[model samples]
Target chain A: MRIVVLTGGIGGARFLRGVRAYAAADGAAVTAVVNVGDDAIMHGLRICPDLDSVLYTLGGGADPERGWGRAGESWTVADELAAYGAEPQWFSLGDRDLATHLVRTTMLNAGYPLSAVAAALSRRWKPGVDLLPATDQRLETHVVVEDGDGQRAIHFQEWWVRHRAQLAARRFVFVGADQAEPAPGVCEALAAADVVLIAPSNPVVSIAPVLAVPGLREAVVAGPAPVVGVSPIIDGTPVRGMADKCLAAVGAQCSAAGVGALYGARSAGGLLDAWLVDEVDADAAVPGVAVHPVPLWMTDDDATEAMVRAALRAAQSR
Target chain B: MRIVVLTGGIGGARFLRGVRAYAAADGAAVTAVVNVGDDAIMHGLRICPDLDSVLYTLGGGADPERGWGRAGESWTVADELAAYGAEPQWFSLGDRDLATHLVRTTMLNAGYPLSAVAAALSRRWKPGVDLLPATDQRLETHVVVEDGDGQRAIHFQEWWVRHRAQLAARRFVFVGADQAEPAPGVCEALAAADVVLIAPSNPVVSIAPVLAVPGLREAVVAGPAPVVGVSPIIDGTPVRGMADKCLAAVGAQCSAAGVGALYGARSAGGLLDAWLVDEVDADAAVPGVAVHPVPLWMTDDDATEAMVRAALRAAQSR
Candidate 1:
């Protein structure tokens, strides 16, 4: 089966490890349509957080301690940048991490599309899955804030890193998204997919941006493949990241029921043909969508593979 | 006196070390308008070679062994970039060196002009000389090449680093130079100078690009201050760098006299009112430009200060 998965970062990358295992055993092809909303230019190099997480995890270089960044990483470059008084000092650039950024940024400047660049970068990792950027154009995710002064738009990183997403967000704006065309092969992959799985990623920041690009969501909905979404929220909270803060911006509750309702059924114009929530939320109701309850924690390759198998069955039914 | 010096890289930076010493002792306000033509976006970082040289040399952090890059540099980043199969691999970005590039490239992307970024960077170095990029615009130096593949333009790094300047050049194009205006305050420094000394830098690549910028050379030639150029050539060859190859591109010889004649005098529409050559080449003459002979080698601070004194005397005569 041609499996197409939409993913965010760390959690998504780890889940990909499970998917890769399954695909390797079955000779299946997996194409991951990664979110570029978290993509940023830090220290002069373009960093696609989700893409890197997935790459590093599958490539066996991910740090077990931090759960992100390259394993056995050194901080010589970060210390130097700090010594020079570079601000937003929280995010770190490992010596090995910089190599990936340098290559990505260089190729981006050389006019290669981000999708092509991701493919080129993947050659070294050989992650057993095709990685595709949602769009090649600049589609920055911005948070609209109502400060004491007034309303203004803050770049995603400013909200995430600088403020740690503390401010009450009024709305989220996917800047340049209106004009952004889907990356080459993204629409085709979605249209041709036998199964479409949305991994438990940030609904507002990750999956939303992937869906925001012009033709991507429509393609998934129109395809013969059934679209399935795994809930990022277990009972009523995210496993990682500031997804609750972003969900609150759109006036949505943090519960699995709330997210499932937000993405009802394809016939109802919401995202889900099937919604997979945690077993804890077995009693949850998502109108017009096929709702199933499963153990959602992806603690190991076995747990993740179980989740993947459940998602595959959900898609196969429709 | 507010002294202004025009400089290139390595040699220019070493000369600035002596100038800074003289300026500190005499309490002179020194401003260096450095050439940015050697600047390139390497591996996605904005690399100002001349500015870096000045910063490292005056900050006392320059590698004594390589005479460029930082002291106690590590190549972890370069090794990783190589592992990823990065191109144009001759120039290595050491871990320490990568920090400077990261900071500069990040700031540039944040919309700070190169001149302002240089000012911000120099705060850490406190290089004593006010280092200003010659132009805010990207005026990359490109050599026009004629080969079996026909005529093509390659980046200066490709020609210099990758090819090692082995290819014969028909002409050197300062791409975007005609559209580039000098960075603010460059003309003001030129006009306000008591004396302007052109450091013993590569005449074609460094000095020529500064002159190539619209109105900068004209402003220098017409300013009240008498401008003097110190020949980079000694004993019919460049003291360092591939100045001979670049000089030949502009149809000039490698001898002190050949380069001296190339700059002629202000009245004849070139760079100098006076030309400084080695004491051995004192007889090498140009018609209108005053010629002075001095020990041009900056083997130490004392030698550099002596060269500065000689330049002042020559300016005083004119």
Candidate 2:
């Protein structure tokens, strides 16, 4: 099976790890389309948070403590940047992590697109799964907020990192989305895949931006592949991240049912043939959607792989 | 007296350590105009070799063993970059050193000139000396080599770091020098100084590029201050670096008097009221140039301060 998986940050990367193990057992090839909405320029490096998280997590080199950056990372660069009055102290750039930025930045300046850059980067780690950004062009997520006079647009990082996603977001704008082209192989991979899985990541901030890129949503819908999404929300709470806070920005409920409705059926153009929610919310229904009940907590790779297998079965039934 | 010194990498930064001590004793303000010829875009970060050398050396954070980068530096980034199939590995980029590039590249991308970026970087270390680049504009030094087809231009770093400066050079070219404007405050500091000291740096590659920029050489020659140059070549050898090789590229001999004649008196339009040579080369003479014999080895602060005082006396005599 040729499987295409769309992922976000830590939760998404972790879920993909399980998927990788399960897919290898079943003799399947995997291509990961990563979200770059969380990409920010930190300490002068172009940091693609979600992509790096997925890369590091799968490469057996991610810091288990931070669940980001590289294992056995040092902080000399971070300390120096901090001493230099660098802003945005929240996101730390470790010594090992800097190597990624340096190479990526160099390649980018040398005229390689993000997809090609990711391909080059993946060659070193051999993360076992092919990785691709949602789009080659920049698709920065920006949040509109109410200032003293009126609404002002803030870069997603400023809203997410500096403010801790605390303010009421008037709108989420994916800057450059209008002009961004889906990365090479994305459409072909979607068309040829046996299944498409959206990892349990924040729908509003993470998955939304991936789908927001032009032609990507249509490709997933038009494909014969069984498209399924794992719910980030369990009962009325997110499994990880500030998804609840983000959903509030769109005036949506934090419930699993609400998120399922938000990402409705293929008939409704909302990107799901199946939606997997926690056992507690098994009764939740969406029109033209196959719902499944599972433990839904990725306590270990085995548990997460079980969830992946269950989602695959649900896709087969649909 | 307020002193303005011209410097290049390693040797220059090391010499400044002594000058700093001497200036502190006299409570004098010192400004250092650093050579940007060695600066290059490696892995996309603008690496200013000389500026960082000076910054780290004065900030008490420089790596003593390697004599560049920061103390307690990590090489994870370099290892990763290498794994990604990066080249020019001879020049290592440490994690802590990357912070400086991050700040520099960021500021440059944001439309700030390099001189302004240097100021911003200096603010972090407060290295006491008013450090500045020779020119804000790109004035890259290129080596013209006899390639398989014909002569082609290669960047100085590639020639120096990659080839180890072993290739026979047809000529040396300072690209963009004709168009480059001397950085703000460069001429002003030179014009008002009591004494101007040329550090024992690569005469052709380092000092030449600084002089190549328009109006700078003229400013030095016309300044009320007397300009004194220290020979990078002692006897027939370079104290550090491959200066003898670089001297050959410019058709100059690797001797104190040979370099002094190359930077001849005002009648010849080169900036040299006095030329300081090591005690071993004291007998060598250049027509119409005052000569000072001193222990030019900057083993520590006391030795460098004595050299600085000798240059002052030479300038005062002129």
Candidate 3:
């Protein structure tokens, strides 16, 4: 079976681990079209946080406790940068993580596209699934917020990491989404997909920006494949990160029901065919979209694999 | 008295430490005109090896044993870059050192000239002397060598570090030298100097590249300051680095006498008014230049200070 998954952030990395595990057992091919809204150049290094999370997790190098970055990462470089008072003091850039950025920045400056650089980096971490960026073009998520500057837009990383999303965001803007197209291999993967799973990531900033790529959403919705979206929100809170803050910026209720409606039924000019939520939110509903409830705590690989299995079953219910 | 010393490489760094110590006692303000020949962009980071050596040495951050880079530095980034199979694996890129390059590269990309970047970086080190690049423009020392591919030019670092100078160099080309002018403040420093000390660096690759700047050599020779050159060679060999190979590439004998004549008397249209050699080369002669001999070994700061004092005394003898 050909499976195409949309992934971003730490939550998506955990979800992809489950997908990889399930695909291994089913002898299925998995292609992960990763979000690039979080990618930014800082201190002359191009950093792709989402792609690195997936690479580290699937390649057996992720810190199990932190749920991101390398398992044995050091912070010598970051500390040195801080000592020099280089800006953005909030980033948790590790020494090993910096190596990835240095290589990526060099390649990108050499005129290689983001997708090609991702593929080159993947050679070191064989992340099982074929990793493709949502778009090769620059599409950044910037948050508009009221600050001392009085209504200014800041890059998503500054809003998410630097500010910890404490400052109330008015809205999220995908800077270049209108001009971006699905990167090479993205449309082909979606067209050939037997099942397209939208891994539980921030719907507003992560999945939205990926789908915002001009033709990406159309390809997934128009393709002859079931689009199953696992809820990033369990009950009324996110398992990780500040999805509540993000969802609030877009004026959506932070619940499985709200997310299901956000990624509405394809029959109603939306994206998802089926929406999977936790058992506690079994009453969640979206018109024209099949909603199913499953035990959704991804405590370990085995538990995540079971979650993936349940989500796939929900795909058939639609 | 105002002092302007030309410095490059590790040898020049050691020499400047002495100059700094001597100037502190004499209450003379010193400005160091440092070479930029060893500069290169690697992994998208601008690296000025000579400037770094001076910074680390004067800032009390240098590894005494290695005579270069930061003390107590780690190689997590370098090792990680190598694991990714990134090019130019021969660099001794420490985690701490990478921070400096990151800051420098970012500033350079932002359109700041090399001289301004040097001063900005000096704010952290407070190297106790004004650090000026020989030229703000791009002027690098490239060595033409006979490889299996026949005569080809490669970066000076590639020759010195990667090949360990095993490749016989045909000649040294100062790339971008013809169009380059002295960096801001360099000509002013030279014109105001009471004495100009040529630091004991590789005369060919190090000091020559700095002089290769269009009007730089003319400024020193024409200015009222007495220019005293300290021979890099002691007892017919360089104290450090491959000065012999470089000297041979320029078709000059690797001896104190040969070097003194190379930088012949200013009266004879050459750089030096006086040449200071080791006691072993006391008899070394340059027709119109005053040659003075002293124990030239930089065993420690005190020994280096004594040597500097001796070179300053030789300036009056001219």
**Number of the top candidate by TM-score?**
3
TM-score of each: 0.84, 0.93, 0.98
- Candidate 3 residue lDDT tens string, A211-290: 98998999999998999999999989997899999999888989999989988989989988899899999999989988
Whole-model lDDT per candidate: 0.87, 0.86, 0.92
Q: Kindly report which residue stretches of model 3 are placed more than 4 angstroms away from their true locations once superposed.
A: none
The residue-level lDDT of candidate 1 at A197 comes to 90
Error of 1 at B21 (Å): 1.2
What tens digits encode model 1's per-residue C-alpha lDDT throughout B152-236? Answer: 8887778887888888877899999989998999999988998898999888888888888998888888888889888899989
- DockQ, all candidates in order: 0.64, 0.71, 0.88
lDDT winner between candidates 1 and 3 = 3
Q: Quote the lDDT for B233 in model 3.
A: 98
Least accurate 10 contiguous residues by lDDT in model 2 chain A:
A85-94
Model 3 lDDT tens row, B216-265: 99999999899999999999999998999998888888999988887888
CAPRI-style grade of the A/B interface in model 1: medium
lDDT minimum window of 10 residues, candidate 1 chain A: A85-94
TM-score of chain B of each: 0.97, 0.96, 0.98
Ranking by lDDT: 3, 1, 2
Best by DockQ: 3
lDDT (C-alpha) at residue B210 in model 1: 84
